[model samples]
Each structure stands twice: as structure tokens, then as C-alpha cells.
Target: MASAVLDHDPPPKHLDEDEDNDCPIEQVRLTVPTTDDPSQPCLTIRTWILGIVGCVLLAFVNQFFSYRSNQLSISSVCVQILALPIGRWMARVLPPTIIRIPLLNWSFSLNPGPFTMKEHVLVTIIASSGSGGNYAVGIVTIVKAFYHRGINTMAAMLLTQTTQVTIFTPLNPPLKKKQFLICFFFLRSPVAGIRLGRIVQEILGGFSVHVCDSIQCRALNEEERRPKGGLSRLQFFLISLGCSFAYYIVPNYLFPAIGSVSVLCLIWKNSIPIQQIGSGLRGLGVGAFAIDWATATSWLQSPIAAPPFVLVNVLAGYVILIYILMPLCYWTNIYHARRFTFLTSHLFERGGAPYDLDRILDAESFSLDVRQYESYSDIYMSTFFAISYGIGFATLTATLSHVFLFDGQYMLKLWRQATSKANEKFLDVHGRMMKANYAAVPQWWFLVILVSMTALSIYACEGFGGALQLPYWGILLAIAMALFFTLPIGIIGATTNTFPGLNIITEMVIGYILPGQPMANVVFKTYGYISMSQAITFLSDFKLGHYMKIPPKSMFVAQLVGAVIANACYFGTAWWLLTSVPNICETDLLPPDTPWTCPSDSVFFSASIIWGVVGPYRMFGPGSIYVSLNYFFLIGLLAPVPVYVFHRLFPEKKWIRLINFPVIFGATGMMPPAKAINYNSWFVVGFTFNYWVFKRHKQWWGRYAYVLSAALDAGTSFMAVVAFFALGNYDIYAVNWWGGVLDDYCPLANCPTEAGAYIPNGCPQIQ
Candidate 1:
């Protein structure tokens, strides 16, 4: 929930298109469409036909792009836009004949009158729901590609020493269709958080990110509520979209150096220390910068959408942790830091070689081979990677503490207000219309879903002959975990847009209990953590339905049907890609400059090995080298207390409340999947537009900043897909040239400092 304090639109300095904000925007001037048609056809043939088409297409497209190093997709907004013309055309061309079924006493028409806004909303709900890529699919990637395959992409850097060791002794190399099919049933729970989130809600909720999406509907929808001058929103959006699309080709395919230009690396090309300090991908990235939107917005969400305060707070923590703390830990050779690379998520041996799973892993049990492990070297990490774990431990506790300290009153007030008899009075026209015009979905419907999903979850866990390994009681415990965190997480999310995930806690808990079983740990975390995320998203969709005045029953049907169909498509698409893609997630087998490197899946696998296979006890238990990192949890818990006290003591100093420990600690959470370049470039862009522009040109910033962010995302995503199809995928691959790939000319950055340490290809031995 670090992004919980990401951004919020304060009291508007200027009026909306047809609005004067005399009342608070949250209270009275919410951006929901004021007018609605009670009789507008919502769940007609048009919605089903169009929704299914969009859902299936997006499900395929999103899943397809996810494996790329620079992931991009045809966004749901694109579906929203494309769905309009197709929807309208279907309404016009289809037969208007009505058919009646006398036995059931039901009647329906093939053509619903001009595709209504409610139909549009339902279509969107269905398609977007389907396109939310399944998170549990990562388990498939880990199992099929990383663990059982005996080869996986290590990182951007490769080792000279050769070893092809499967992380798992033997599961199935190719995941049986049944294994992934089980995950599909659970995909109904957490679609939105898996792939994407809406932008306007993100800004208001304060966690809007531009990652995974090039085109966003949030800006368009919000801008529609505002007055247009000169170029219209669409006109400006299209223009920027075209510009960013064209510009990305340069950095993305042609001159990759444009994406990350480290002056220090360029100036001192032969100096190992200089390269180590300057490489954006491999090293500290002290003076790195990028003009590319993809790199800038990859890790952190769009800076353009963030407020000045949010950017500053994040920048403060980033500089302090990365610049100040990381360097100190690494340079001082703490924990034998000099034995490993300067910064990386990959684990290593004490002797500075990649940790060989073949040596220490028990082939039969998928557990640690204690005897072999003792004979082999202990697992170690780069100083930065080690610190990242400490940050994660701290972030989880800090999120809860920060919420109670700062937003407790607001939350309590909201709860009281919600429970009070006067709650009905707060209902706006949209809410009242939803209540009056639509029959509410019965409570039993939810109970049925809950019971059925629970049963399926248990079956997924244990029905596979203990393959998934989670007990039935473990399923209940997971649900209970979700139930426990839901209210607080919901409150924190509702109050602040950021959702602090329970992945860490869940992993820690399950690791402590079920140490040897790797599958159980990740599966438990998925149900506990990802389940809560999906629940929040489900609620958010309901809120949107209410805002659009869609029938409650229609919304329910759309969501359920969409989840089922979309999830199947999501699974089918992923299965196809996993089976078909040559080498898949294994960079060891793939050709150089290949785009099929699965960075996220690699991180997920690392996490499974650390938290699940080895167990947290082995990694963070007593007698472990990094046991002190656990103290960060306590540190995170109390970190907010001082800030709260300071805020209380000096009521005048408004800045103290901005100190978000969750954001600070959690900032590095994405480090492995993300790297130094992503963070450095993201901070630069976020600071530029949010702080510099917001201060100097509030009017322009308010009008076009969000639009530009969305447009860049849209343009970049479109181009990426195009580039992949045209040049990067299949036999074509990225063109060979100095400009064809991203590099900071810092080849020695990943080299270790200790004597006898070595790397592959060009990486030098330290001796």
C-alpha cells in the first residue's frame, strides 16, 4: 500500500466543464454521469456478443504480451473504444425480431436499441474482467519454465560457468493442462489487480499506475467532465498517442542507449568502479536518466498523475535507500557483499557462483538436501538485494501502522457515517437511482458463489492427490486470512488508494508451518493475498456499476460470466504461449537479445525457492546470516509512531504526515523484476511533471498531464505490439546493431569485487 499516498486531486483550483465546486468533489461533485435511463437495454444480445468478443481478444492479447522483458498490451480502454463502433454496428445490422420461450415465459430481442451507456459499461466490465491476467499462472511459469525445465533466464547478465540444474527435481516439465486449469477456477477472484487498474480511481484512490497500460480510460472519462478549450481531449490524446508511439521506436528498437544514458559510464568506459557506480540496469545508477516513457513509467506509475507531495516523499525514500544506504552496505563489504554483484535479485553461493540447485536441492521431495547443502556453499545475495528483503519486512508493518496513525479518524468517521441512520441521505442521484430502478442482487447469490468457490478451491488444493498440497483446513485458514485483512485493507484502500498486500505475511506464516512443500507456500499466499486484492477490485467494479446506474443483477451476471469466460481464455492463451514459445522463460537456451525473457516469472520463481522451497526459516531463521533483517518488521511497526508524534506535536508542519513508511520501504519491493534504471527514470519523470509542472503550470498540468500520461501508455503499448509482430518476435528478433539494444556501456557492473569471482562472455574476473 506504499502507493496508497500516491496521488489525490485536492480542491480544484478551477471549475469543471459545467461545474463550480461549491461542495466538495468527493461529497457532491463526483465525476459519475448524472443522467441515466432506467429502461436502457443493458444485458441484451449486443452486450453479450460484444462483451464476449472483447473479453476473449483482450484475454489473449494481455497474456501474450506478459512474457516480454518490456511488457505491453492492447489495453481494455482500446477494447472500450473499439467496442463502441462494433457495438453500434451490431445494433444497426442485427435482426430486430423478438423470440419468446413459452415454457420458461421468457422473451428476448436480437437487436437492442442503439447500444446504451449501461450496455457499454457492462461490456467493459466483462472484457476488462476477462483481460485481468491470472496471477496464479506464475506458478505455472515457475514450474514449467524455471523449476522442472533445468534451465531458466538468470538475468540480463549470464555466468561463464556452465550448469543446467532444474530447480525442481521432477514435476512435469510441460505443465499438464489440468494443473493450470485448476488455477483458472480461482482466477474468478483477482482479475483487475493481476493486469491493470483504472486511472481516475487510482488518482482519487491515490495509487494510479501507468504500467501494463498504454491507453487509459481514466483520463478520458475525467476530462469529459471538464471544459475543453482549443484542441479537444480526444484530439490532444490522439496527437500525443501518435507522438509517443513514433518516439518509442527510437529508444525501443533503434538506439536503445537513448532509454538509459549514464554519463558516468560513457565518460569512464574502461573503469570498473565508474561503470559499477553508473550502470542503470546493473549498478547504483547514480547519474542515469532516460527520455523513454516505457522505462520511466515501468516501475512507478505515471508521474504525471501523481501529486507533488507524493513524488517528493517517494523521491526522498528512493534517494535515502538507494543512494545513501545501499552504497554504504555494498562498499563496506558487509555480509561479504564484495563476493557478489553490486545489485541483483538472483541468489549466489558463498564462493561467488550462481547457487546450483542440482547440488543442494533434494530431487525427490522438492526440499533442501541438508547434507548436500552443508557441503555446498550457503546462499547469499548482493547487498542491495539483501536490503530489499529488509525493506519488504518493514513495509508490511509500516502500512498498517501508518494507516492507524494518520487515517484512523477519517476511517472511523467513514465507518460511523456508513452505519448511521443518516447514511441514506448521503446517496447521490446515481446511488438512489440504482436503489430505486434496479432489483438488488439477493444475498444468497453471494453465499452460493462463496460456497462453490471454496469447494473448488479445496479441490484445487487437495483434489489433485496432494499435488497442490494445501489441506482443506488450509483453504479455510486462507479464507479466514482474507476475511481478517479484507476490512482493514478495504478501509486503508478506500481511505488511501494503495493496498498493502498480504503476500509477505502469508508467505512468512505458511513457510513457518509448511516448510518443505514449495507449492503450498505460494498457493497459500495467492489465496490469502491475491484473493484480498481481487475482492477489493470486485467491490470497486460494483461501485462503478452503481455510478453508471447499471442494474445490480446485470452487473452481477456480467462480472460472473466475464470472470468465467475470460479466465478460461486467460488460461488457454497462456498455456498456448508456454508450450509454443521456444525456450520460453529460459535465457540460457534462447538466442541473444531475445524479447521472450520472463522477468516477473523469474522473480516469482526466486521467491518460491526462497520462501517456499527453502522456507523462510532456512532463509531468515535463527542462525541464518540475515536474521537481523526481521527486525525491520518491528522497525516498520514503530517507524510511523514517531512521524505521528511529530505531526501531533507540530500541528503546523504539514510535511510530517507525508512521511509514508509503507511507500518508503515498499518502494524497493519491485527491485528484482524492476531494476535501477526503472526506478531512476521513473523518479525523474514523476518529479518533472508532478512537482516542476504542478508548481509552475498548474493550469496546464491539471488539463493535459494525465492525458499525456495515458496517451504515452497507449502509444507505447501499440508500438510494442507492432514491433513484436513486425521485428522482435519469431525468427526476426531485434535488429543487430549498437543501437538495437539497451546498454549503458557498463559491462563490468555485474562483476564481483572479491578475488577469484568470475562472469561469462565479457564480464571480467576480479582476482
Candidate 2:
């Protein structure tokens, strides 16, 4: 259930030692250097200090340009532009690619571009922001706004998705492609920052940086070098076509039976036991049926089968329990990893010539600890209700406060240790200072590139779709806000700051400004969705860098370039066309009602108030009760369930399994059901599968399953892109149901109906 976007990818290390290959992995070497005096300055901190300060100023500048006059919030666009300059700075950590520009000498750093850890991180962060954040925000908003009747909203949203195949067939492929690409890139991109950071360190320290044919050099191996694998690319294309065709004709035929079967297959293949899967499926079934039934049952108390209120409470309880307990518990694991580093090598097993676990974990040998926790006891009890309750009470005065803030010294120590290990493993030396070898670009040069890229993207998105107005600026602003707000928070929220509440707030803004226009609404929603998706993608990559001891500064730049490439190649053109082209409905490939076009302004408005205001109240007042009550109950539930279940089943030495209970919290929190599962049914299926595959088949499943899942995801995304674009699925349809169905119906001469043909409002002047 964790967002794939937020999960860090494994640092690639190729085993085949081929001299003729240009694999970066071949160049990478792991060596440990002598530790120096702790008094010496850390370049990583300096880079962040400068970058952070510069970024805040950049954010203010972007805000100035965007919010100056445009009520629509062009600040997002400014943020994107601002990133270019930051990107340029980030590029120094990349390999310098010199280009012949006739009279002008041109060179750019491919640090975050091509195949690099930073590229992976950026894409992952962004994607997490979108996919993980989207569902989280949606669930949270629905819960907050419709607390008494939130089931209706959740049902409505699900119902809306049911129509996704029938209504937005053209858009789904593109959306899916982007999602897949971001995930793919994160999983595949190889080492970037460590090599470049080493070079930069050499430059700053005036140490000679040299090229080598050694298999241990700090570069991605040939197999992992290419940003996109052929298989993955082919898969995206195929999936796109498959989804389009399925939407065009199969939905009405296939969804009834095939959908359920597919869900079962996915569940079965995933390794979940039938029993647990059944429990989850049962919950989902009750939820799905009850929502619609409740709505039907509640029309002036006209009885459907059961009372609507009963359905509401049951569904709400399930949702609340799932979101609160499952996610909360799993987060305990993530928190445990973040807070108490027993050993990086122990927590994560990244295979391919295993680095010495002893060397990696030995506290005396390497500074393995970062973000010092008060104690292992604190981390173990992060899920403890009473302790956290006291802390939560203090944080009530501030929305940003947490019960277990990582001590700065602890993080510094960890950073030093990670750096020491990376240097020893890759550089064979320590005490190398971080500095840029290349000169900084003039402000004007950065401006020119930024303007040019922005212009091209705008043209691609707008020149085609005359109907859907893509908020290019909003995308920029959102990125800027993410950069400014999330970097410091680190491992907070579901996945960094790509929290759903943030995106939902953005959607609400879109609704507030451009209400009644479904086309605009959807396009704007895409901007919010895509930005966050990439944010989490990038964040995950960064996490990988952390684990691998890659330089944080270099990773930062690689992520920026990854974002730029993804936007240009995958999302920019596709999103533009989705917005411009208006004939998608003619092919009967998609539904007419989408989140953007749904008659849900009330929902949006309510969400804005609830998440932006009421939900935040948990930090104070009676709202804190929810956090406290849930925290305690979760610990109690976790403590005994592991012991009880194992004891009841095995009846011998169940205490061995008792120790594994904390993992439940970590897994559940690290993986949220929202991002991981498409629907409630999938959640059940995934939970069972995860437990079965991970717990039972730890010997075989542990080693190969992650690889398989990653492979499957990469294949799925690759096929999606090719299939959608090559087949022209978005362009294949040419119908405007809203315009045609109600253009001449006995409404006014011209009306501005939201999306459906129903006369929800009086007619306005027809364009």
C-alpha cells in the first residue's frame, strides 16, 4: 500500500566486468578512507544551506510573478522556471556534455539527466506527490468534508472511476504512462551524485579527478545506464493501446466479469493467502455496494435494502480503521528505519556483490547513525499511544511539530558516516571538499533556457487542445512550493510533502477560480497530480542516495533534470493534447464525468475548508483526540495480534514471530493502501499477497519478488506509453457528448452546464 513513488530504488552495481562497455557501474568502486577530525567542515551542509536560502528567494520571485496580477495563480509556472536556474546549479554534479554551437561554445551537465540516482529520485518524488498524494488527499478530504456522509463522496468518486474506462479512455493511457515512467525511471536510473559529487569534491579540494576503466568506478553499469529499457518502453506502448481498446469496447462487456477475475488473478499471483485476501475483499465489497445502495436508500428515506446510515457508519469505520491503523502502523516501520538505524545493510538488502554488512553496520568503523533518536526505545514505541500523546499535545500549538523530531547531531553523524562509506567505496580517499569544477552560468543564460523550454511545453499542451486550458504556471508553482516546503521536512507525511491534503487544496483552488468548467478542472488537476507524482519519485531516489552514501547535492540536481525530461517527452505533449483535443468522447472510449468535470464543486469547497482548516485542528482542540485515540489503539492492536495469531496457528515458540509485529506497522505505514491498491478489493488482495510472499516465502520471495514487482511495473509503464501514442488513442475519439446531447435540448439558447447534458444551470451565451 506504500506509494511506489516514495520507495527508494536500489543502487545499481553490475557484476559483469566488461571493459568495452560504457556502464557507469563499471567505474564505481567501493573503498573506505581514513576518517578525519570531526571539527572539519561538511560540504554537504554548506551546499544545502546555500541551496535552501537561494531557493526561498527563488520561490518569492516566482510568487511575485505568478500572484502579481493573475488571480488564477501563475505562481506554479514560475516555480518551474525558477527550477531551471537551480537545475543549472545542480548540473555541476553531472558529467559535462559539450555541444558545438557554431560560434558559441555550449556545455551542459547531464548530472540529473540520462542515468543517474538523482534522476531517479526526482521522478520518484514527483510521482509520489501525484499518485500517493492524490489518493491520500482524496480520502482525507472525503473523510473530513463528508464525515457524516463521506461514504457518498467516496462512492461517488469510485463510481466516477468506474466510468473512467468509458469516459476518459484517451486520457487514461497518458496518465498511466506518466505514472509508469516516473516509477520506471526511479527503479532503473543508476548512480549519479556520488561520482559527480566526488568530482566536485576533488575540484573544491584541488584533488585530481580521474577517469578509470575499473569495474568499481562510481557510475551506472551498461545494463542500467539507459534511462529507458527497450522492454519497458515497449510495455508502455502496449498498455496504452490495450487500455484504449479496452476502454473503447471492452468496459461494458469486460468490467462485469473480467474485472473481478483480473483482480483475483493479480491477488493470487501476488502471494497473498486466500483468507486475508477474502477479508479485505469482503470489506471492499461491503464498502462499494453500501455506498451506492446508501445513496439510493436515502432518497427522502425511500428504502433501498438497508438503511443508508448503517452503510455510512460501517463504511466509514472500515475506511477510518484502514487509513488510521494500517498506514499508521506501517509508518512505524518507516519511522523506525528513519529514527534508529540498526544498520542500513540489515534493513535494506540491495544485492549485486553484497557490500560487507559488517563494514556498513559497524558503529566504530563507519558513522552509520543519522538523525539521532533519543533511543531505540523511542523508535520502537513510536506507535506507543501514551508517549506520542504527550508529544502530540505539545505539537498542538504548531501544525509542523512532531513528537519524535530527529536530533540534528544525529543526522550530522549519519551524514558523515554515509559520506565516509561512499568515499571509501567509490573514491578511495576521504577529506575531499565539495566544490563545483565548472563555472556558474550567467543569469540570462539560465533565463533563456527556461523561457525556451516553458514556451515549447506551453505550445505542445495548448496548440492542440483548444478546450482544456492546462495551468502551466500552476505546475511551476507547485514544484517551487514542494522544493521550498518539503526539503526540510524530509521523511514526514505519507511520502515527503506530496501529501494528498496539499494537492486537494490545489484542486480546490482550481475549482474556486474556474468553477463549472470540467475541462479546465481536469487539466488543472493533472498539473497538481503530475507535480506531486514526480516529487515523491525524486524523493525516493534521494532516499536511495542516502542508503548508498551518494552525495545529496548531486542527487538534487539529477532529480531536476529527470523531471525536465519526463515533462518534455512523456507528459508535456500528451497532457497538452488531452486538454486541446475535444473529440475523445465520440469513440465511446471514456466516460463524460471526470473529477475535473464532475459536479463536485461543493465537495471541493468543503475539502478546502476541512483539510485546510478543520483537519488541521487535530494539532489542537478536540481534533487531537483522533490522533491520540488512534495511536493508543494501534499499539494495543499491534502488540497482541502478532503473538495471538502466530501462537494460535503454530502453537510453538510464537514469540519468535512476536518480534515481527513492528514490521507490520512499518510495512503498513511505508505502504499506504491508497497508492498501492487501485480499489478496495486490490487493497485486500495486496495485503494478503504481501504477507504471504514476504512472511511465508522469505527465502525465495524475499530475493526475487521485489525484482519481479519492479520488473512488472517497468514493463507495464513502458508498454503504456507506446500503445497510447502510437495508436493515437487520445485522438481516435471525436465526440462531444455534453455539447451534442444538450445543445438543442429544450434548455436555454446557450447554457454553461458543468459536464453532463442535464440543465444544472440556466443557459448562457453559447461561446
For model 1 the local lDDT of residue 136 reads 70
The residue pairs that clash in candidate 1, if any, are 1-500, 4-498, 17-227, 205-497, 214-713, 214-714, 215-714
Query: How close to the true structure is residue 410 of candidate 1, measured as C-alpha lDDT?
Result: 65
Tens digit per residue, CA lDDT, model 2, 102-171: 5534322233232332232232333321111122223322232322122232322322221110100011
TM-score of 2: 0.35
TM-score of each model, in listed order: 0.83, 0.35
Q: Residues 225-277, candidate 1: write the lDDT tens digits.
A: 43544675666777898998898888777776777788898899777778888
Best by TM-score: 1
> Residue 702 lDDT in model 1?
66
Question: lDDT of model 1 at residue 216?
Answer: 35
What does the lDDT read for residue 305 in candidate 1?
59
